[model samples]
Target: MARRSYKTELGCIACEDLSLLGAGKEGWLVDNPNILCAIDTHSVALANRSTILVLGWSDSDGSRLKIRPELSPIEAEYVSAIEWLVFDEIRVIVAGTSCGYMLIYSLRGDLIHKQMVYPGRVIKLRIHGTKKDLIQDTLSGELCVVTPGAIARFDGSDIQNMLLKWFEETHAHFWGLKPKRQGSEDFGNSHEKLPYQLWNVSKYGNCADAAITGIMPPPLIEVQSSQRYYCAVAIGDDAVISAFRLSEDKSRSLVGTILSKVVPATFSTISSLSKMIWRSEQTSPKKPDQKPQSFARAAPLTCLKDHPRKGEKLTLSPSGTLAAITDSLGRILLLDTKALVVVRLWKGYRDASCLFMEMLVNKDIASSSSKYYEPSKSDYCLCLAIHAPRKGIIEIWQMRTGPRLRTIPCAKGSKMLQPSHPFGASMSSSPYVPLEVFLLNGDSGQISVLNRTLDT
Candidate 1:
């Protein structure tokens, strides 16, 4: 009966939904809104390669205006990722291309600095320490670019200064005067002129997941930051989520191992969530007389066993304490990044893009856990949002354990774009900030913003 069963049509579910945001441009929109950041909720900038669109809301009355700007001259380059960066009081939109290029643009869409960081395709671009999360171990404007071959880290100090120099150069070019020196074109296609330090993750192959955090090192490193420790979790084609103590000197961070990242099969989801209980049947444990690795070398104390299903993407928790890995088999492994263990497993979600939304855990929900003899915490919840486009729904799960917290059905829109989280700056502004998740319908390019919060 279970095998024969099928999901209910999402269009039939007459439940509460999000507000309509906007429609795509006559089907020319390739993907969803690549919102780097929003000056405000209504004012957002979306860029994909040569195309750039900025939306703003009028201050006097709440009305939205869509602004499209020509961000780049070259039309052939493919945009892999877009990021909004604010460092040293310098704000810009960074566009990473598939052809191994990073193009920095001003707020007004002027190309500021373009450089070639990786030789291969830039798969993921994470600009750490944005305007919202300003006080990070990372310098004001550093970024991490993940390519299939390697993961590269770029410094922000030079880029911020170069932005100023570009303004000067633009002034020089305008008055029919030439700049003093024809600068070197060692990295980009002659136009890019930024002096940023780039570091490669020489330890992994085809990195799939990565995130920067201030998590405490697991007694492995000799040196630690007094204010906030800099570290990151990285997983590559191997499916091993390796944690490292990133260096204050971003260059040396290329090396160093932190802790393990796998849960043994004996305690895995194969046992079933309802019947699953922690046992001492773990296969890999600490060896006696095991020596700690040096901070200078990149090594993980342990790499968890790979999931049977092939992993598609990795999204870390807002606190950097957990990692959610989505695999081809429609399973999401909620992993504890600190201990490198699978805390929980959620199954039956197919082709889902995950995001984190914070909300207060209510009193009634905590008391209801007693039926399972488990008590929920009341402070805050680690809500896992699984956007399953194929299913035309967003599933919300509570991470305290593998429980289906809520299921948000999609409206009937056949022209829906891909699902994505709000930009990092917006996400980090307030961990518990109430957000209206704009769910896209698969038709007509219409959007629906989730109006109500799951306060209950």
Candidate 2:
């Protein structure tokens, strides 16, 4: 998909109350006012009416809305976090906590499956695109290509060898495993050869019985698969943003090793990643006749947003150009993905603890003849919104200029919304809203949405 670079208004159709806040990728418009808020991403689910208390959108047309889901029943309330996974059109997985149980529900409100994943209260729950056939079957079978057996069959030893090669090529300190050393010959030798053993469990079965028996035990085959497929890992207090891979081949392996982290700025939470752009830089040679030396930039720039409670998450734009980050103080930072430098920062009034941040790019903004404009770029025209905690105080800022663009006050007669504890914001390149702000409501489990109107 092409990168977006313009901003437009999104109209709001409905609002809903949620006990706790969460974000999804898909957009939604509900017909019921009691429903209050609706968001659609990989999956579509609604927060119970009583639990959700606030809703807000960045665009006047309501393209993006934030909803906070109510907490589970006290007996089932061990779920400390909730997350969504949109696998294709029909399969949306809502993974949340139910005390000791890690519940996985479908978008259709059916209990598909549940597992006892963790021992203590479930702090966070993240479900990335799965490699399981069942999960793939829901997403149009594309994910089936990622099965361990399939990866082993297609990539063979080349995948392992590539990772080994990458480790060697990127780092100068190979712990005496350099090609110049004789011992280095065995470095990737195991990867080059597949080590699998097949055994016939019923090899000695009675011949007469085997012929009479309608069913016979099949041979047991064990594929000694390499462990190179551990490409993605989730890190944080609750593993909010779990990383996964889309490819297994060596040439594309680095791309598959994306680090996905969660942004906790807004209730409409999302994950982002950073891509490593590798280029060779030549150094001056000692002598004119000597060849210039080249060096590899091993560390790619990383982008992460602040978490509601602690830590941060990282995300990559669809076009891989901009990296967004949110800080614990409800501050949003945008970075050049390739250069790994901060290009812009957006801060709201008061700290935006547990608020969400999104990017809305207006194509018209790029086409405009403004000296600060560039049409060919994506994610240039960005808009940010937050569900403010204080009454009559919603802050919105332009990322490029770092200027406060608008501030929307809370509705009249509404109680001031305040965060139970101070936290930070997160940023991303989704083009939905540059930032979705939120304020936690003490231990009451309520959140309030603030709309910021730019002061002309």
Candidate 3:
């Protein structure tokens, strides 16, 4: 007989109550509320509509850290997404609001910096970073802010430098020393605006969600240039999957285009010309003379075959070569990010959520020397974990035609989460910290972790 899979080797279960936030509570019309959550090594950020709370990973004292954003009294907005940002031994919470404002908060619940990213609602904020090799110190990272019709990218170095300056100034005040700039209280207003590259991705369809999958290599016949092009993949209702090539050349907005021809370029500078026609598109109060934002033109790339059902949620693999998308019809489509093609599909699993995970190749062996075990060659494999709510099971299946490995019975209101690794870290270091998945029980407010184990 074939050897049985080690489903029984799932190890070291733990739980923490989460009932106070009312995250799992359900009603007649609203079965699943739009609750946003992000996890780091030591803390968890949970947002239920407007209120946001941060709790210690395992604090017995039950202390809650609440972030209070400074908002205008005239307009109201709610939180849409939250993520933990780690750079240079500092950890902070980054939150996006429905009114297109990005806010950064210190762990002590003070707003560090705020910026208006877009005039429309912010859909998602994705942070992607990578290194050339394990030994090399050179690294690259970017923050992609996605909206319905456009996408913008902020360089990682830009954000890091801004945070460093703020922290240094704050420290100087603590020591009662003369600081070069204003104190932390005035820093927020006088903060410099971070320059970003914007792209109009509304060609294929309005983007429900999107990400910068990877940077494409230049073509053989291409002219030598300093600017690098990027590939952006988007998901929507009309078109299930779409992609675009983002160019560096600036594209004029409708208002900007009309005024450019009427006004002489020699008479007015680029910044002055843009501000003359740039109008406020948002309901939030703002000065009419605010600086105008610029965007680059997006060229259409290959699009996946149109599907009747719309995609609901998307998750990407660690390498970013593959993406798992769940749809309205209870099916999951796995796509090759580089090729822009669907490689695999699964049906009959409605209202499902999927996440990419890694499993050890050799499950029978045990490493007893220490807790920090260095993995050897051919040690791990990529897998997809699917949470099927109708069947009340969490299924782990091997990727690219591999067989199902485990079917775990989970609670009805549970959610699967992938822990965010520290920013600016090397991908080679991942082997030291084996990839794992977390489970949050919405009904009972309990948290649990699932780890691989040898036959006991």
Q: Report the candidate with higher lDDT, 1 versus 2.
A: 1
Sorted on lDDT, best first, the list reads 3, 1, 2
Candidate 1 lDDT for residue 179: 50
RMSD of each: 16.9, 25.2, 5.9
lDDT of 2 by residue, 48-104 (tens): 332322233334323322333334565545333344433222232333343433343
> What is the TM-score of each predicted model, taking all chains together?
0.60, 0.34, 0.83
lDDT string, candidate 3, 1-456, tens digits: 776443332222123333434533452112635578786665667776566677764654245687656555456677778888888587878888777778888777766788887656678878777664556766767787888877889888888888887788778867978654553445665788887887777776687888878777655566867877888888888777888877666767553354344444444576466666786354657454333365675667877646687867787776678889888788899999888889999998898988887776575444555667666535767889998978988988888679887888887767777666456775554555666777766555556666554332
Predicted candidate 1: what Cα RMSD to the true structure?
Answer: 16.9
Clashes of 3: 2
For candidate 1, the lDDT comes to 0.51
Looking at model 3, residue 7 earns an lDDT score of 37
Compose the digit string of candidate 1's lDDT tens values, residues 231-257. 666665565555655443432332322
lDDT-superior candidate, 2 or 3? 3
Best by lDDT: 3
